[model samples]
Target: MKLAIVGGGSTYTPELIDGFARLRDILPIGEIALIDPAEQRLELIAGLARRILARQGSPARVTTSTSVTSGVDGADAVLLQLRIGGQSARHRDETWPLECGCVGQETVGAGGLAKALRTVPVVLDIAEQVRASNPAAWLIDFTNPVGIVTRALQDAGHRAIGLCNVAIGFQRKFAAHLGVEPERIRLEHVGLNHLTWERGVTLLDEPDGESGREVLPELLDRFGERVAQDVRMPLTLLESLGVVPSYYLRYYYQHDAVVRELGARPSRAEEVAALERQLLALYANPSLNTKPELLAQRGGAFYSEAAVQLIAALLGTDGRSRTQVVTTRNDGILPQLPDAAVIEAPATVDAKGVRPLPQRPLPPLFAGLVAHVASYEELAVRAAVAGGRARVFDALLAHPLIGQLDLADQLTDRLIAHNHGYLSWA
Candidate 1:
């Protein structure tokens, strides 16, 4: 089989590369391709990927391409790790929403919509290229604004999987909270990308094995404080939910939640600069190992992500295990959202491909929490694929931040302008 990374120069490439290299023992061998527009960074990351492969003495082919068509042609899997306009654009994405009196945050409310508008077309073009070049390729997207872009691809009828490592990551935290081995815990959850839930959990082998037996103590105040200030964001949401969430939370904390929390909002520019400086500096720093170490380090974090490993565990050679997955479809899963809306949950995968677990009703707390966000995600998908002002307006109004402003019309005008060229409005 073959594997390709669409935005190969990504700062996170090494994590996945390192991840796959270690998996050589379990999965079949294959060639790998790296595609990126940033020539220097692409070459650097490619070189690192190759060196790592060579060091491990793995026979996986490593090729570099400036074009997605060439990179993904005839591939088994395509990993999309794209960040359009890089740091410069992300700064605007993070800062603008707050200026408009909306909770300016990343990957959730208005901030994400702005990013989604600019990102959808580029990602759609990439999806089209993947479809044309390799019809059977499964696009494993790890991009941010993941919910929006993935929905666009699904709406356009492309084969893709929006994989987030959050589930397993949170499972570990929850397991710790409940004093159980992470692996033994079984779960069911539903929500958008970074924002999610822990509806239930159980020991795999225990009798009368239900959640009522496990007692969860309180940690919200402490957890909330930890997540709110740190740049490693996502911790705050975990604290907020009374579960330790995965990913960074500093960006998520500055939103309307600031008002919800203490009525004090920090400077937006300061928030944007945190990640901006890190990525720009990483790119600037010459220490980025462009040698064999790159591949060695690539994908080092996947053990925890468990998306591919979970698929492998359930479907590959030792086939039979299963888990929850996020799937798009308004269907029986969530009564509030449309039947075609994409929802995240546990799934089963094997040689037969993926099957969404039977739809489980979301709890009132989480259901009410994510309802508007889910609406934004669904509407954003329509805006990207259908490209009408109505869809854009719907997406804008559907967001918690925008709705809080009660100026959906104004927010809609601004968002449309922010993402003006990313769509095909008539």
Candidate 2:
């Protein structure tokens, strides 16, 4: 099958290429078209992609293009991993919010709102081009603020499904702790993208004579310190919640502390900017065909596996039928949330498309936070599509992380001032 990566110039492309090489048996990729406006990065990434495929003895051809229409034409699937304004813009997103005494994060709170406003319009334009090129092709989004972006695509009548590696990363970690293969571990991963909790971890292939048991608590107890450290949450909090929260939750649960920490250090965007420079230098090395070890520090662990598995399931390329966690429309899977809201949960995937699995109502603790964030996301989408200063102000006001009216007003003005070039209506 022909697959195109929309932001193929990203440093993360090598990790994805490694997955395509390793999982060739399941997906059988024939061609990979790298689409990006950054020609230098595109050439570097495409070379590494070709080298990785060659090392695997796979015959998939690697091509590069700057035109979305040309690159995605006749492709079976398109993957969106683009950044609107690159790391420089992200640096602004991660820093400016601190002046308002809020956590400076790229995927939540004020910074996340900035990203959504800038990204949604560009993604929608790309989706339109993809539809013009090949209506049958699926758009797999791996962008930040995925829930909002995915809803925008689906609402605009695009065939899209959002993908994140958080669940898979958790599954792999839990599997390692249990001394079992990752496939045997099934996580009851629920909530909006980036904001989720692991309520249960069940063994899919329980050995004979072994009773079915929920392993999340045991896993937490045995490795609570390490888990807490990884997520930057207190061990006591995890124990109290009785559920392992995603690392992103740290921004919400410890907003003030996180703001202090952020203020003391360089923005994550700055760190990544330095890292990307080194990564590009490494990519330029002709001898370097395999994914570099430094790439792991860049995060998105297990992203390739997640993307490949999701695509294989969607295209019915993988012979086995199974359910996998993905980001898609609620469709009653979350009765408490709006039907048009996007959620990340386990869903059965096949040629017919994705079907979210039924989930029991979340407990009040989790439900309240999710509903609060969902409300903000709904308004964020509206502001992104029908841009206006008022819409943006309302979105910030609605966010639980930035709920105060005065702070919202200040943040709204700051966001527009910093991102006016990208926001046409502003």
How big is the positional error of residue 31 in model 1, measured in Å on the Cα after superposition?
1.2
Residue by residue across 1-426, what tens digits does model 1's lDDT show?
677888888766766666666667655447888899888888766766766666666788788899888888888778788777665666556556655666555565666776777777888889899888778777777776877777788878887667776666556665665566776676665666666655455555652243434332232443445433322445434555554433433234445555343225544435444643455455454445332333323332443246455435433545554564554444566787776566677766665666667756766766775676777787877776667777777888777556543576776676677666555673
Which 10 residues in a row give candidate 2 its minimum summed lDDT?
A: 204-213
For 90-124, candidate 2 gives per-residue lDDT tens digits of: 99999999999988888899999999999999999
Number of clashing pairs, model 1? Answer: 34
Q: In terms of lDDT, which candidate is strongest?
A: 2
C-alpha lDDT of all candidate models, in order:
0.63, 0.91
Clashes of each: 34, 0
Instruction: Output the number of the TM-score-best candidate.
Output: 2
